[model samples]
Target: MSTAQATTTHDEIVATVTGIVAQELGVPAESLAPDADLRSVEGADSVKVLRMIAKVEREYDVELEDEQVFAVNSIDGVATVVLDTLAQDAA
Candidate 1:
């Protein structure tokens, strides 16, 4: 991992992702728990979810696999993929 990525904790990723999700999905960040399903949120659709993911990708400078991105349904899941991607990049 890069020096920064190596030091980034799971909770920090979750918090940053939660903020991006809230802003993109028009929901309060407080309402989005780490395990909260993005598809279950009010007004959330596939397009919105994809948009949120895109924003998150930009924030972290990582391009997630479509399979990985779609396989996940929560902020925690997204964070995991990002963490994995970062790990791979560093490797």
Candidate 2:
């Protein structure tokens, strides 16, 4: 990844994850809040969440653990896990 991609900010990651979740759930990105519980959203399911995770992984070029995927219940949580994974890669 280029420096720009590698240095993506936490807010940017949350925005991207929110977009991915919104796309997967067929909802508007602006409709989803960073702190909203993804699983509790209308039309949300395990399959949709998994698809969102897959898209997020592809977007960030990181392999997230299944436990982390399931444990993450909001855009902010997903962003934190992704940022941590990226930081680990950098290390």
Candidate 3:
């Protein structure tokens, strides 16, 4: 992927993941920070978090391994996984 395209993809993945977390947790999108602990959010639980990850995977057409998915504890971590998965898919 071109450098520009990679940047765009990363931004889109971050934005989309932020939106997903906001929607699933009933929090405002603007309140989501890359370092925020998803578990600390109101209405968030393991099941909801898993569902959110599943939605993200489907949205990006990337499958995250169970170990990677379970290890993601922050928005930034999730973004990294998304980017890595996209890069792998492209390769």
Candidate with top lDDT is 2
Over 1-91, each residue of candidate 2 has an lDDT whose tens digit, in order, gives: 6696688999999989988888788899999999999999889998888888899999989999988888879999999999999989888
TM-score rank, highest first? Answer: 2, 1, 3
lDDT digits (tens) for residues 19-39 of candidate 3: 999999889999989878888
Candidate 2 off by > 4 Å:
none
TM-score against truth, every candidate: 0.92, 0.94, 0.87
Native-to-model Cα distance after best TM-score fit, residue 73 in candidate 2, in Å: 0.5
Rank the candidate models, highest lDDT first: 2, 1, 3
Best candidate (score: TM-score): 2
User: What is the Cα-based lDDT of residue 37 in candidate 2?
Assistant: 96
Encode model 1's per-residue lDDT on 1-91: one tens digit a residue. Answer: 3477677878889999999888887889999999988999988999999999989888777899999998999999999999888888777
- Candidate 1 lDDT at 72 equals 96
Worst 10 residues of 3 by lDDT: 1-10
Off by over 4 Å in 1: none
| Model 3, C-alpha of 91: deviation from truth (Å) | 0.7
**Model 2 residue 43 CA deviation in Å:** 0.8
Candidate 2 global lDDT: 0.90
